[model samples]
Target: MTTKRKPELVAYTVTGEGEKAYWTRIGSAWAHKDGEGFNLDLAALPVNGRIVLMQPKPEGDAA
Candidate 1:
């Protein structure tokens, strides 16, 4: 058995063409113990530059 913690990073959509560009929250990630890479939890990875890793936005800023 194991426990879960707050996500270390978030995944989102930031890829597409001109008018098609859009943003959407997709998943989260956790830093690996080795500090080499991350353990990802994603809905689905995009083919292009469709996903990016970013810190969670500050609370109460906006939705």
Candidate 2:
């Protein structure tokens, strides 16, 4: 009996000095059942940047 991993939309942004300053959708996140941590399924990790994980924003919550 195996449980499926819940995937959450994760966003990656290039920041800091000497790195590409841009924001884009990088990949999906499979969170653990315990709500402690998760894993990312990225197409390719940016050479220089930062990675941020969060649940997908609601369509009506756009600012």
Each candidate's lDDT (Cα)? 0.78, 0.65
lDDT (tens digit, per residue) of candidate 1 on 7-60: 889898777767886778888989888999988888777766568888987778
Best by TM-score: 1
Q: Candidate 1: which stretches are off by over 4 Å?
A: 1-3, 15-21, 47-49
Model 1 — TM-score against the truth? 0.66
Q: Which is the leading candidate under lDDT?
A: 1
lDDT at 16, model 2: 56
Alpha carbon lDDT of residue 58, candidate 1?
Answer: 77
TM-score of each: 0.66, 0.54
- Which lDDT tens digits does candidate 2 get at residues 1-63? 133644665657556545545566677777666989866678768767577666877668862
TM accuracy, model 2? 0.54
